[model samples]
Target chain A: MAKVLMKGNEAIGAAAIQAGCKYFFGYPITPQNELPEYMSKELPKNDGVFVQAESEVAAINMVYGAAGCGVRVMTSSSSPGIALKQEGITYIAGAELPCVIVNIVRGGPGLGGIQPAQSDYFQSTRGGGNGDYKLLVLAPANLQEMVDMVQEAFDMADYYRNPVMVVGDGMIGQMMEPIEFRTPVKRELPSKEGWATTGTKGNRKPHIINSLFLDPQGLEDHNIRLQKKYKTMKENEARYEAYNMENAEIVLAAYGTTSRICKNAIDKLKEEGINIGLIRPQTLWPFPEKAFQEIPETVKAALTVEMSEGQMIDDVRLALNGKIPTEFYGRSGGMIPTPDAIIDKIKEMLGGLK
Target chain B: MLNDKRIRIIVGHYGSGKTEFAVNYAMKLIEQESNVALADLDVVNVYFRSREKAKMMTEKGIKVISSAIGHDANLDLPAISAGIFAPLQDETCQTILDVGGDATGARVLAQFKQIINFMGYDMFLVVNANREETQTKEGVLRHIEEIERQTGFKITGLINNTHLLRETTLEEVLKGQALVKSVSDETNIPIKYISAIEKVAQTIPSDVDGEIMPIKMYMREEWM
Candidate 1:
């Protein structure tokens, strides 16, 4: 297939359909509205279902209901809307149902303006909803990755029987770039016959798709099983990209839109004889902490740059384990830090280390 | 300048390929003459607007007025740049106003009604017969009516720019041209151009009624 120019949100939506997601439920939210809008128009034509739910709360519940029926389903929203869907998300997690959730994150802490922001890092990577549950979050920096990740997310969700989040921001959601959709891969998945609630057939036992285990012991057993699955995810699914780390004295840690900026800053620093490298965590959950170990012994420090108030910095700190000094710089409330700004912050941090 | 209008404003449905047409049209204007200014009056849409190509346009000496805050920023807090008015007031510059999509987006045009009226501008409705919303002559007419009613600017001409993303064929292009031609016949609006992909436009028979504009599909889907 030939490459086409597409907005990130629209490409992600098409990618979801291409991955065999037949049901979509979402609410309108800026920076991510195009996803729902595209699905609303395109999904039905493909014999897929698209419901513009009354609210974010309703939309997520719809996702839960559809996923329980063994159909591939998805729901997307921005920050505040995602916050509303968290309770449903936790319920979906607890039930061990597979579904794809996309959060084209925006500035937040409470409706904090609509430009791109990575403030949702802790909310996404850590359990935002109440419970010991984790979403396999994929952070894509460009439109092509945005398209690829959403398609891969559906498979990951079914593979683990857990929700997979394709995390991006307004920059990833609204930007237009050339992308070619790769041919859909045939992924092996667990048969839905055993678990899906497809209504009672002849001699088989009815499948009960519910998170409620009234008995404390039963709930504990379920939680333990879920934990075991998460352990497997942690062991296998952590993904990261390294750039210019051949011989670096400084490492920059970032993800999604901020990661792209860091890459540019790293190139600019290289021209100035400053060997700055970057470690971009493609998956926010099960973060590629191992990449930090690859930071050369010559490296004196690591700087975490973000569009939030240093949320990902904690992960960098945890990854490095104080073997080397780690510092943070960021801008929040929809303010995007430019490459030059990142370079200055890197210089300041390196100056301090020296 | 198909209709000899100094300021050509392109309007259409959300996915009607308006931005792509506007970009190609702006490039054509620049190729023909020097003083060209493209105003990104599309405050309604956050993506795929002419502003995304501002650097390319400006590098070629074409003045561009887009987002005041940041480049390619989808900020909901729309702050229209004041420089948009300079081209409107200037007589020499061949200005192109790329308005946002649909009736609600056309509401932004009301802000420049007074200046546009005083300056005498031409509004062209770009139609994509392939779009689900405007697949027939009735649908096309209804959309045109709705856009005109909302924007309060009667469209002066029609631009047929139908396509199935990058999968468009010569047959589909001709089918779309026929639909838009029916619309032109019914409404008496001049068919300014029938936009076809570069390959299709080259092969279009000379007997085709309107001017054929060979456009590269700048706005496209992932799997072309």
Candidate 2:
């Protein structure tokens, strides 16, 4: 099949459909509206359901209802909208219902402008909702990756029986790039016959789907189980890309849109006799700690760049664990630093390290 | 064939493929000269606008002028680039204005009315009959009237850009062409061109009312 030029949001939505996610529940929000819009039109054609719930809160709970029924279900929203859905998300997480949630993050804290932003890092990686659970967060840097990750997210969600998030800023959601899903995606999902809240029949016991555990001990046990699953995800699903790191003296840590700029900066700086490389984390939750170990013994420092002030830097610091000097630079409140600006910051950081 | 209009303003309802037409048109115009500029005057939609292709267009020697604030900025605050006037004054260059999608989006063009009037420009209204609101001649004219009223500009020609993304078939093209013909008959405005994907373009009936503009689906959803 020939490559199709697709915007990030629509691509993700189509990927969801092709991934066998037959149900989507979401309210419209900027930078991510194309996603739900696409679903509203296409899902029905595939014997799927697309419901525009009254609110983000309502939309997520709808996802919960569908996921608890053991079907591939998903929902998406921007930052503030995602915040509204957190309570329901925690419910989904606690219920151990597999579902895909996409956050084409926009500037936030409260009704921030509808622009590309990475300020939701802490909200996403850390539990945004009140819970001791983790979402397998996949941060895609480009349109193709966004499509691929969303498709994978559905299966991963079912594989772990946990919620998965494909997080990116407005740039990834709105930008157009060539993408090809040459072959159809087909994943063997776990059967929900034992746990799904389907009607009781054939002398089988009724199934209940609820997040509540009034007993402290049982809740603690559930938390430990979730932690174990997270540990396994960190060990097995941590994904990152190493670019030009073979002989680097300075490494830049970034992800999503900022990482693309860092890659550009690395190329330009390398042309000027500078030895710089990029460590791009494709999955934000499983922070790819192993990639940090590949930064080479000759590297002097690592600079973390983001659209947020300094959220992901904490993860980079944790990954490095004082193996090298970790520095941070960012432009927040819907502002993106230019590649040249990042190059200058890298030069400054490298100079300071020396 | 559209070479006669050096300054063409493209307008349509949202999802009518106006930006796709504008981008492709800009690419076409640049084949004759390097002094071409495509101005993205779309403040209504933050996504799927011509500015998203600015970098690619620039690399191909066509200047892309977008919002004064920035191309990547998603804020709905409407503002035009001051540099847009340069192409308007430059008779040597061909400039295309990709106005926003609907009457609400077209309202931004009113700000440039004075200059547009002084310079004289041709405006094309793109119609996709597949869109629910514009499925009929009455529906198409209703939107055209609203856009004209909103921008105080008249539509000089019509572009039948009817498509269902990659699923667009020859039948769909012919159906849209017929609907566009009815619209042209009612308004007496010329059907400037009819668009289709490369394969469907080859099957356009010989007696179709407008010139054939075979376009690749540059703006698409992954399902296509």
Candidate 3:
């Protein structure tokens, strides 16, 4: 359990191996490319399957095929390549397959340019692939969480018979940091193997994996079952990190790589006698909205810092519900604001209090 | 026209070498005895990004303002200091804004309308034909439109950034020139320079001003 310096992406690969994931299928994409490369070398030593897929399209389907067999499966890609995988992802979700996907997001509407970008904030949480299906999404801010969350992602994927995503950005993928997920959390073995494509015994009916239900009633039943699962996920899976809140006059909220900058800013302002706190979101989809409602009354204003032009800020606005003044600060397209830059904003917002 | 500022807006899609381009071009302008400033606005990225160049640019007397870093070394969140905006009024200094990716990036320039008008900026839209987004002429024009729309400023020229990270050859540059030719044909934006991998860019004629990637940049002590 000793901590080791690892880029977030490599940590994910290590976490997956520890979680008993024996197959990885993916193509080359910046930031997250190290995950697949690590798998190509490491997975085989563990007697696992590692395929350098022909394309992002090919990779995700290979994941779909591998996951359908009820073995742990995963893939990694950046935003543009992730976009290509969406079609396959939707199919995976619809079929109720359990798999993990890591998107080391780079900027994009379409090949929006590589380097870390959080413009895909909406894509990951709001269901990047499509449909009424929900994927369990975990947003990791550092290498430690990158190692930890991939295991959690696999557990959640199996526990709920759903897809899970560990969404980080290029910084997390490339930057090495200390981590300690050497011993993964013990997870319950999935109980539904008779229905899984694990080798069938003579007595049970063969499990046919299909999202298509020919009858309207059956499809409605499937959709309703998925909705109920989503509702449970929302209720039980909201996680976040809150810092320095008792007398915070200004709260800076961010996630993933940007939150580290926010934490740095908060530390500086705290030293300078400014009462500032931070809220780093750990799960973006089942956004821990209740955190805002539970904010200390001494807080006067809050703001959102992200790697995009005010995408995640909208969520902060929803969570706070105008109870306190909320302003937004961000720089987009792989541009990260320094802690000092954010502290200036905090001071300016606090300066008006008198 | 000696007072004509060497102000340039080096704009490009991500990984297009715009940051290096802005740095080198500003150094060149500074070498020619012009006071220079490099304004780093890219916030959408975190590593290997443009704003880190600010510390060195500041060391060179090229006034650097990102969100200017405070004493503690975090960004200062930009509000231009007095008199810096009216660059035309100043006789000797030049400014370069290294934007992030595409339109979303150029949107930050809206904050600098004062400078844009004071010194009519020379907007250079770097066209990296190898980039997935900028591979076609339509893609290049579309990028140009996005930057213009976001910054409310026009790109006066283009830089053909056709280098494949390490695979770029002169033969590849010729093909990229064809891609730039199509952009020129469709949008009438002339290519001011064409950059390539070290060897390819090095072999270009001196008049071309082709750019080479720096092997290293001095890391700032307290990096932001």
What TM-score describes the B chain of model 2? 0.94
Best by TM-score: 1
DockQ of each: 0.19, 0.16, 0.03
Candidate 1, DockQ score (0 to 1):
0.19
The residue-level lDDT of candidate 3 at B127 comes to 72
Per DockQ, the best of the predicted structures is 1
**Model 3 chain A — which ten-residue stretch has the worst lDDT?**
A1-10
Better candidate number, 2 or 3, judged by DockQ: 2
- Candidate 1 true-interface contact recovery: 0.22
Q: Spell out the clash pairs found in candidate 1.
A: none
TM-score of 2: 0.74
Displacement of the residue A53 alpha carbon in candidate 3, Å: 1.4
- B1-224: candidate 1 lDDT, tens digit per residue: 54558898999876678888888888888888899988887877765678878788888888988777655666665678878889999998899988887887788888888999988988989887766567789999998999999888999888888776546678777887899889999999988888878987887787776788888766442211
* Count of clashing residue pairs in every prediction: 0, 0, 17
The models' CA-based lDDT, in order, is 0.85, 0.85, 0.75
Rate residue A17 of model 1 by lDDT: 93
* Candidate 3, B-chain TM: 0.79
Ranking by TM-score: 1, 2, 3
Scored on chain A only, each candidate's TM-score is: 0.98, 0.97, 0.95
Give me the displacement of residue A300 in model 3, in angstroms.
Answer: 1.7
Residue lDDT tens for model 3, A1-354: 433435466678888998989999999876676688779989999989999989999999998888888898989899988889998888999998999998988876787765677888888877766678887889988677778888888888988888898888878886655556655566675676755776657877778877778899988888999899999989988899998876988887899878888887887777888878888889998898999889998888988888888888888899999888888888876677788888888778877866
